[model samples]
Target chain A: MDFEDFYATSKDACLRAVMATVGSRQLAEETVAEAFARAWASWPKLSAHPAPRAWIVRTALNVHVSWWRRWRREVPAVEWTDPIQPPPDDDLPDPRLMAALRTLPPRQRQVIALRIFLDLDTETTARTLGIAPGTVTAHLARATAALRACLAPTTGQE
Target chain B: MTQDLHALVREEFQRVRLTDTLDDVTARGLRVRRRRRSGSVLSAVFALALASGVALSLPPGRAEPDSVRLAAWSVRTEPDGTLQIVIRDLADPDGLTAELKRAGVPALIEFKEVEAVTEPGRLAPHCADDGEVRSPLLLSVMVRPTGTDKRAWAIRPDAMPPGTSMHFVIFSVRDAAGKSYESVHMSLVDGDPVPCRSVS
Candidate 1:
């Protein structure tokens, strides 16, 4: 697909997927924008990937991890808090679910984001994340169970 | 239960929109492409020079002063009045900035520590721009890699617009594995200088 078309169709989904993983809309938007710019630079190579959307999401997550590390070092530990805020718009995700997702380890959140939001299959997700398929499955299982546990009260399940 | 959980999580994000226009994104992408192309050209030239053992020769009867050679960097005025700067390390940014000014190029230099994964060739986040157009400033400077931890820059002071200065932000990137390297971004600013915010 032409870059314009790919960007037009995938931009929102990519933003939503990255926002789901990072739990910060502003950061997600910035990260996804950068990732898409990078994809544009390497369009020929990226266009051939099994899952270009997954590539965009993975790149965004990587950017977030880098930012988080720098922020962690510069800021005091006591000042660190979950950055998850209630969606400012009605169409955005629930703040409670975002908070729960943020509680997962970074890898688990990434696995769930790729699997559910980007809709990458196990092998494709593993390739994009540089993890083995078995590991991806393990992370997905653990993350799903934890999210379910956290949301059980809202779901009316004991 | 797993399917239900996945559905719930997916539903939450289904309606979120990026709001940024494609034109904006593509404009940023074009900048990225230009930056990458410049880097690639420099790398290709450096490789060819190394393979051919090419060296720069000074012009005979040149009145230029002897080049200032230091452990961290070297600066020399080319015969055509351009400044050739080779940076081996990021030490003594203030001294280097002073030397560049003395050599007749208006310049400011800063070194910052950032995440190793930070993308190269992008302007440092701390530096602010004056929002003025600077096509002339872009044409006045050229940078190429000289070695593993070194870079060579050629700046034409005459080509720079009056009241404009070259601001160089050299990032010191250290990965989790303790390996580190330096990358630089040079920008042209018009009018009064904008000081970079403290990263601390």
Candidate 2:
């Protein structure tokens, strides 16, 4: 298929993949753009691969992870500097839960997003994160535990 | 409590879609498509100019004036009739020839003088020199076709600032039999060293 078709079919999946890894919608958009640029240059080869969507997702995640290396920081602490849409107020019922999410370690956050939000199976999420399925399980367990503690009601607040 | 927490986390992410529909994604892809095509065009023009200079310096009949310029070090023919070009730039012609032999291509390495192409000097936002950088220690090795004029050459970017690299350009020119000849070019420079690796 042509490039337009490829992007149309794969962009959201790519974005979800990046958001899952980076835990930020803005970062996900940036990573997706860079990955699509790479795919454009190597479309002939990438398009012919068995799993092109997976390839784009992997590349986007790698780009996100590599940005941290280039900055000499293990985590992407670079704050969003431009105008951002305010957090949607529709379905989300708790502000404290969102705050608690930002406190989790980046990898744990990724595991929770992929497993719980995007609903990827262990193996696919593992492949996306370039980790083993067992590692994904470990991260998920830790993330769930952390969230349970962080989001629990305090004696006075509830 | 565990299930409740999971539910909350899911609720948070699901609420955060970026309003990015397929149309938005397609527009982004089209932008990339334009950038890539333009990049290929620029590289093609640069390769043609470099190849033309190489053709002028060739001994009377050895060079194909109409051939494409490539930056490859060696070329090989596949069993299925596809051509594979290995790119490199070093003083050792014999090593390149050996690589071609291993790949089963009828190989010929000719040493010739050609002007090096120079970069335009604008730094990319990421600090990558816009890839317009050129140095003269460059060389080209054309792969002779056993029965056809079409061949692939490998390119090696040698000789630039420390950690600097360049890409060779390939041109598709048709020979007398309406067949295509693919030529590759590479740059080799002093002091600035090339990684002992291949750029595909």
Candidate 3:
């Protein structure tokens, strides 16, 4: 499909995917814009591919990950948390939960994002991350366990 | 933590709306591509202007200077419209042939020796008023249209004495039907000639 059609059909999904990976709205926006630019350059070559949307999404993710790594080299990772928003309250509110999520490891964050935010299955998440399905399952397991622990006290699971 | 985390992640994901706008993305992409095209055009125009200024400043003597030797070569094509040619100083006749062969062109290019034109001296009076001498020798090759009106030429910078300025010219030609294409000129100066290369 043409660029306009591609943007219309895939923009929301692409943005969500990037947001999940990068953990910042500004970075997500930048990465999505860059991905779309790259896709525009290769539109003629990618149009004939079987799944152009997937191609663009994968490209955007890769770009975001690469930028994340590069930026990591320049800046200390000690305070790698999202600066745009604050942590959640003791209550099980949506914003609080997101604040807590911003504390997870990068890979764990991406696993949760791709699986839950983008609503991709284990296999698709694994493929998107270029990892084995078992690896994806392991990351998801660790993420779920951590999140569960963080929410237990609030829900009176103790 | 699971329920809270899930809701939080969902909200965060929801907070991010798609912004890969066609108007913005495509506009930026097209702008970059057009910028590159314009850069090359500007470079070419600058080169042409420089070359014209150099050509205009030359002395208009009636005959080639005696200090330099001259040579000319032409190739004619059949009905199919394919012509190949190589021209250089007669002293270096085999050099051009060897170069063409090394470049994987056909061995039967059939180099022809036509009457020599007045050999412009590689050294000429400088543009400055100090009466400084400069080298500006030129060598040219042409693929003349046998029956058609098209003509292509490749002119090389003349090898003049030391301290002389060197100049080169390149050109291209197309047939009436536009199906036939030919390299009119690929030129070089002072030292060995390099192929056409562009950056940017």
lDDT of 1 by residue, B65-128 (tens): 3232224666777779878776655677788888888887777787788664445554323334
Let me know the TM-score candidate 3 reaches against the reference structure: 0.43
lDDT of 2 at B179: 48
Candidate 2 vs candidate 3: which has greater DockQ?
3
Q: Write the per-residue lDDT of candidate 3 for residues A1-158, one digit (tens) a residue.
A: 67778778777767776665565556666667766776787688878966555566677677666655433322110123333343233322255455566767878877886777556778777877789999998998898887767656755753
Question: Which lDDT tens digits does candidate 2 get at residues B1-200?
Answer: 66676775555555544455555555566656765575596677768879887532211211212222233243444455444553323334445545543544323333322222223652111112333444443322222221111233333212124433333333223434554333233333233322222121
lDDT string for model 1 (A1-158, tens) is 98899999999888988887777887898789888888988999999987889889988887777765544333211122443444567876777788899899988988888888878899998988899999999999999988988888988853
Give all candidates' CA lDDT scores.
Answer: 0.71, 0.51, 0.48
Backbone clashes in model 1, listed as residue pairs: none
Worst 10 residues of 1 chain B by lDDT: B57-66
lDDT of 3 by residue, B54-104 (tens): 542212211122212122333323234323342322223244344333433
